[model samples]
Target: MTGTGFGAFVRRAHDAGKLVVQPRMGMSEPDRMRAGLRATRDARATTVGTITLDSYTRVGDLESAELALLEGVSLNGYPIVSHDLATTAGVVEGLYGAGFPIQVRHGSATPEAIFRALMTAGLDASEGGPVSYCLPYGRIPLSESMANWSRSCELFVRSREAGMDPHLETFGGCMLGQLCPPSMLVAISALEALFFHRHGVRSISASYAQQTNADQDAEAVAALRRLCAELLPGADWHVVVYAYMGVYPVSPQGAYRLLGRAAELAAGSGSERLIVKTVAESVRIPTIEENVGALEYAAEAAARTPVEPADSDSQTYAEAAALVDAVLNMAPDLGTALLLAFRRGYLDIPYCLHPDNGGRSRSYIDSEGRLRWADIGKLPLGGLVDTLGAPAITSGELLESLSYIRRKFDCETTV
Candidate 1:
């Protein structure tokens, strides 16, 4: 199936007023991975399948992945690159197509080999960004990542020669998964989508992971949509909301509540898709049944949600727009612009310890439960939002903020 098949499938679901939910599932054994995809496809929701890659494959350690496979050792995820083409193809043979599109989710800063293997397996959609996959996962130099991703995009686009329209999703918005604040997240996600478009990717999805405040997250997704619409004219693009990527709620009730809120956020914000987290997330790798259960639960929650109009005039939009404009103004090329943005601190992720990141930026959860910048660093949002004279976040306060959602939901459940 062509990559555009995935985007088309999602667009159809959204047009029918359905939210397309997907699982982050992968297993080492082909039979197990096939079973997971079958379960995801059969779940009681408008769904898609995901083949998440193993850590060894993610870091390009194919030798180790092959060794694990040969020794019959279990792996955390599917090692697509290490598995033979025919074996991976057989895993998705009859399951993947227009009706059940599958995406390979690999957290790789350098993904050329992964891309090649997936395309060979006839899968066209995948997620990851140069900035997102690089800093959070490892110490790969930002410049090197940019080069790697640029080549990967170009390579992916070649699928069009065989009548396939490959789809790429940006992981930029989920940076650090927690306290980086929404505006920065929105800006980076949009920037990465632009980067993909410039490198010849026509079908793209911009992602936003759920943050602390529901209201704030709603505003962030709206800003992301506006940015993509304005910048990516004539491109096939959509918004995807990821369930909270931080310290998940430990209790089943709390976890389900958090996932429910994420579903509502996706439906209310007019996002086309959602990447779900099962209740088992806080404890361990979820089973196929657990994943299907989460998908069904999220679908039910979303069905009950009414789409709310966005606050276009909100602070989130203004701040995010400012950040995007600042980066685009840096250079004509989006990749170069991103490199320059980080080099000059025009774009900085709060609390990110990567060497290329400008460490001056910091954030704190406000008393109102919203993420706010404590230190804006050299980001060009000086007058848009005020951080001047704000006190630095203390370590104790940071720890509390990191578990803010878990505490809020778990406490509510107990009460």
Candidate 2:
């Protein structure tokens, strides 16, 4: 995590021509929109900035962000990929307004209902039709029991045959909420490779987010190396350097350094495209200035550092790779594999209580084999009956309060 060491590595990768994709989290919906627009403008303004992959939580924000970028930026026919449907609309509309063709992210790998949603969303937003579909939850586990994978894959084939370009995104190190772990991610990556063999994709972007510590992340990286070797032996691909800006507990300086390290590793390993995240995210929602500041930080660091190979002999890397393979082979179905991994605690993303869960959240299992819900509620001590006024208010205000928060933040947010 040394700043100097990691920064130099990132710079070297840029010098060698790699694509770096930075995730600038949105403080509010508006801020997220603004960030997306600014990203496209910045990318189109220079050779260094060619294409930007933007993410949005809601549809309106996506439209707003893409509009902002389309209205101002000029590109040499580069495309922008949005992780949300709303953002896809904005991109399509922007492209039409800018007198260019629009591309949509049609995730045909999802359920029929979801695929229909994507198609309907695309048709509603575009003039010529959607050109691309982005699958953001890393790779799809092709276990037979998961209906989503087969449906989506079939759609991908249909899309390709119809001359539409489809893209597969690969996850980086850490496991985000409900998003599978690196081991599972490795399985999905393998699945994508097999899918691509039958139906050629327009491109593959490794949207690598640095998760966990250097030790854990390095292990995941090693797993990726093995996965690539096994899944995509002779396939041509491009690399997208996704920097984990806000989530890590590390300092902004340390985060940038880690990104540099990752970029160097990717380059030495033969990745072709790279971009750096702007350095502003050390906490919740970075301002535009912070975004600019962060990107500058990574750029300056890269300029000073330059990427090179780090020590590659660690056993952690090998062990992690084996773990990934083992998990992929353990189950007959993707959903079961995923559930089994969760049962064994293979993938553990923090589960906070529903905002309505009155803030009560817990991870520890009780000795009685029961899941304990951490009570975040501030109730008077005596006992549950006492707190509820001798059980008279069992379904009253106390119940109402607990009910509200759980539904608000907990149930709605996570899977």
Candidate 3:
């Protein structure tokens, strides 16, 4: 815990030309969790370990987590807060190293308690964002989530001063994990990283989930990279692309095919890391073997995918830059600027119903399967939003667009 953090390990692996693959894994039982970590480490690929928390732990229901752990009831993930430090330390003691760093991941909008428990246990890395974790997950007010996260970030920074390299990953790019346009995803990712940096975090990762078209995904990640370079100059940052977080492909072959595309996208876009999905993604919870299988598949795919030259004039870059510039100029600090941007409709998310979110914007898939903004609301896109996409889509068209990828990948009658 007093050693290299997740970001530095990822950067080191990247510098050595290795694509680090990680899984969303956890088990309430300490031995099982340790076994999962060992499996991830022994996978035939460059890898990192994860201790994803259960739903109870995620929503701050620590009592339920404790009861489940004591009653021998299996939880979906590890409950770091409910489990004592000895249990967690034993689970990861010999497993975590420079070559095998671990990150604690929970989908919590309010993570103060979680952060405290992690600090006491000497864990250093985690992921979430105020807007991204709040909107899709629950009814927590956006302002409240922001306040909680601000405090958590501040508390976690103490780890850095205590000789631990604490790092965080922003879940912004994967917001709603679906039909949102690439430019919007890129903007949110950039903004959240800035928020983390303002709260005293120097090591962070900006995430981008794979969407429909490979080229569009490539452009989006490229834009994310450029924004980090320009904005996070003093912060240590990298781009991590997630496998499609929407409706997953049901068929094993389809799932693998989709995951392969994500690996290729990450490689071509100059991203340093990838979050993988297993073949069982469309069905039940994946076993450790399935996760390992997915990791190996993605690694092999990354090995074969060639990195293309960067796109200097990408439309994604232009549109995302416009959004970032508009938001940054709205207020003095990143956090207040973000809150004001949403309140003023300058950084609206499509279809997000959060109280603070200006929900006037909408997105749909174009004929070519690229996500396009159906309506840009009051976002200062400089006419770029108006120039692209079809007229506002019908409700039926929206439903079709939501199911677009699932149908393409899961249909019995294939091309």
Candidate 4:
């Protein structure tokens, strides 16, 4: 069978009642990269391939990447820009098709060159957003990142002229991976999806990372879906869930159990795709076999997990809708609205250290293991959420909250 574009491929899989699983594997060597993709395609699950970019390429340091390639030094990920088009294409020449669409997962705030290289290499899908890619990853001014992403989106959409439908996933929901409340995560994700849609991207995916509480995560994902349906009038969109993105459990059993919970979250919440994390996540980068094992395990877990009824009237949905509406009312254009929202502290992320961040917001893990807002900053959720008598989270409490999942899962495995 011939290959299909990334968005269409994923839509087909979800429509066929399969939850697509993907890995975050990348290599410096072309042959090894090709092998990784091959393994993913051959794995015993519905899967997609990822070519994560190296650090130098992610920061626009092509010179260092080229030097490392020449000196035979191993970089963490595939340097797509430093490597020639022929070399990059050869890595997925016969492997990338409808059955296995490959996406470039680079965490670059300024990704113009990265997008250009991926498009040249015939890659039709990538993930990252202006705000989501910027604040947590680097010190690049939000304005600059916004301008850069605007150009990148314009460049990515041009693939349509060549009969390829380009796909972009928002990393907004997974911002900082943990500690932030579900309401903010859901709101940012929906806003970023709206940003992509406004920038002419027709095929889009909104991402949400699994937080501490399963029920809360389910509520958040449901809220995100509802917001997208109401906001994105005529766009092809889906929800993608990433396994717990904070500190992972150290034990093998704990890791597997955590991954299983993530798969269950995706299935129960009706998310179309899941990004799997291996058992070696806490120690080091996982091997090809480990990634494959994680993929298969998640697939098995998803297969038997039944979908739960969505709660449309939950607190998550109410708060997220408020945040999105507040931001949209800030300005005429989505990008400008985002910039103005951050500048005015209308959307503050708890515990995020970037200078662009308001830093006034703070969150804590409640007694029931649910993430709750300790301080809401200038966010417009005052009416929906009451932080009136919430105790301020101390440094000691913050550290413990950061490792909440790791401790919970690891302790459970040992017991």
Candidate 5:
């Protein structure tokens, strides 16, 4: 059987009426990393493999990563550039292909080096974007990240040229993790996917992270799907939902309940893949067993829950389409259009601190816990921007909104 691309693999699962599960797992030791991959592969669920890079490598500090390796320092994630090609290849030997494709996840604004290293090590799938990887993670200048990602996207396409298809996932959807409105997330994800498609990638995935409200999240995913179908016509794409990337619940039961809801949301909203967060997420790095358990749990939740397709023609869709169109109409190309969009306030992420970001926008969770725009800057959303009604959210309310999901899930109904 000819194993199709990573995007195809997820699409096949979605077509087969299943959701593919993934974990945010990474380890510095090759043996541990290999073990994690093997465990994910053998888990009682449909899964994809991830090798998240350490902070040193993420910031383009290969020398620091190498020094930590030699000094036996415990790094947070696998240092892809620091490892030799043979070592990285051996870690995924016989593990990356067909049923399991490993995606190199690095939080790098400058991912050119990361892309080159992963491609050389025989992996072609990775995630990040010029805007998403830049604004939230570091202080890297936006233009530099844009230039780096343009080069990285071109680097990603080399896999297809080498007879191995490559996949690029956009981290745009999960920007700022929580409190950012669903419309902004959907729009950014679509824009980044367009950027990737323009850079010669044939397979891509647009990501959406679970937010405070289930109904709103479902609407956002549906909106994202519609926009992607309309904008990314020539590319193979899928929506991957990350389980609440914000403040996680401390209690195991709360964590499990939240994760189960995430799976249900993914299945109902027609997302092909769901990224799982372990019960230990609030405390520390999860073990392989914890990750495997989370995967299985998510899979089981997805199996029992019948899908309820969201309405694609909803207001969310209209708002997202407006945002996307406004940005695309700004300039001829997506890369430059994105930069100009931010500069002109046509695309503004709420609470984002980047100098490139307009910072005029703000979002707050309403009484129903649905994320609503407290201010829209100049997002070109027409009447939708008026949803930023009345008095602005106080700092205390902002704190409460940030902890909304965690507080709800962690409250005890049973002793």
Candidate 6:
């Protein structure tokens, strides 16, 4: 990804008082390590952290060695692990044993396992300070996930009712595979609309890994542009970019201009926050040093840029909202529209309006993979509304479902 706009966004975020925590995931090489080191030096971030694998982990013990080098360098501490109980337990134990106050991140394939891990980690972390578990509640069946979270909240409320410390530290919502192809820019925009309405979440810093080779530069930029277009809907929302894995830089000076394009897209989309990747990331994990350099380069570019808006109309917003309505309406009917979208391979879904009471409830993806909606007689009721609508989940109701979980746990709302 390009870095030109990233530095400026980081400064914007810092000015806005958002805590920037760049957690480096795949530090698989020395050049990558150098990149990350560079990013650290340039960012001057207040906190930094890295994930480590222990000897007993499915990977190996090299994680411990890696953790050692990162100890003094990173201000925040964290461990990333699988959804398994043993793995989560082992990683949490190892991090704590090292004497660093830390947080744990794990996918929620097995909520039971996560619940147990949280219980243990929270108890242990309490001995040091506030222990947190960054839960990607966004992946759950929204209705089911929200309901389960509500139940969990009831449990916490009951804990308080019983005079016990709830102690469950959670950050709700994560856009991991929120949209596939990972390059659907329009899908990203629709997703953002849904995100705000459902979760009431205003900001986040999420990351994704693309599968393009070093030579596939155009393909890479397209994917990124799609992401930028979708996620950066212009001034309405904000995001702090954090992509450190993959090949770290690209060819043609034009490669560097991609981030600038994304910035332009964001400006046009009305997005409020942004932090784009700076280094070429197709080859290896980035080192802090290289990461810093990439950010500097990106920062310099954003310093001299202006965004041009694409033409649209008030009717356009309504049309876009209609498409969203059609997709979200499918929830009650098994997402017939989403199934159609899948069949049609329509890349975008528009957000035309806010449903009367709240955002639409329930989003369904039909067997065909398109979002479905109720029929209003002969006319097809909903779908992607704009120039090239992208795939996304934008029902306000869905957003609220995730918000319910996030608020219950006091977790980070964005990312």
Per-model C-alpha RMSD: 1.0, 14.0, 1.6, 1.2, 1.6, 15.1
Better of 4 and 5 by lDDT: 4
Could you estimate the TM-score for every candidate? Answer: 0.99, 0.50, 0.97, 0.99, 0.97, 0.40
State the lDDT of candidate 6 residue by residue for 224-276, as single tens digits. 33333454454223333323222233432333444444333333333332334
State candidate 4's TM-score.
0.99
lDDT of each: 0.93, 0.37, 0.88, 0.92, 0.89, 0.32
Candidate that beats the other on TM-score, 2 or 4, i.e. the better one: 4
Residue 120, candidate 4: Cα error in Å is 0.5
Error of 3 at 298 (Å): 0.2
Judged by whole-model lDDT over C-alpha atoms, candidate 1 comes out at: 0.93
Q: Model 4, which residues run further than 4 Å from truth?
A: 1-3
Superposition error at 122 for model 4 (Å) = 0.6
Consecutive 10-residue window with the lowest summed lDDT within model 5: 382-391
Q: Clashing pairs in model 1?
A: 4-165
Please give, for residues 202-310, the per-residue lDDT of candidate 5 as tens digits: 7999999999889989999999999889988888899999999999999999999999999999988878999999999999999999999999999999999888878
| lDDT score at residue 394, model 4, on the 0-100 scale | 85
Point out where model 5 deviates above 4 Å.
1-4, 412-415
| Candidate 4 weakest lDDT stretch, 10 residues | 1-10
Provide the lDDT at 185 for model 1.
94
Error of 6 at 402 (Å): 33
Lowest lDDT 10-residue stretch of candidate 2: 124-133
Candidate 4 per-residue C-alpha lDDT over 267-290 given as tens digits, one digit per residue, 9 for 90 to 100: 988899999999999989999999
Clashes of each: 1, 35, 0, 2, 0, 85
Give the winner by lDDT: 1 or 6.
1
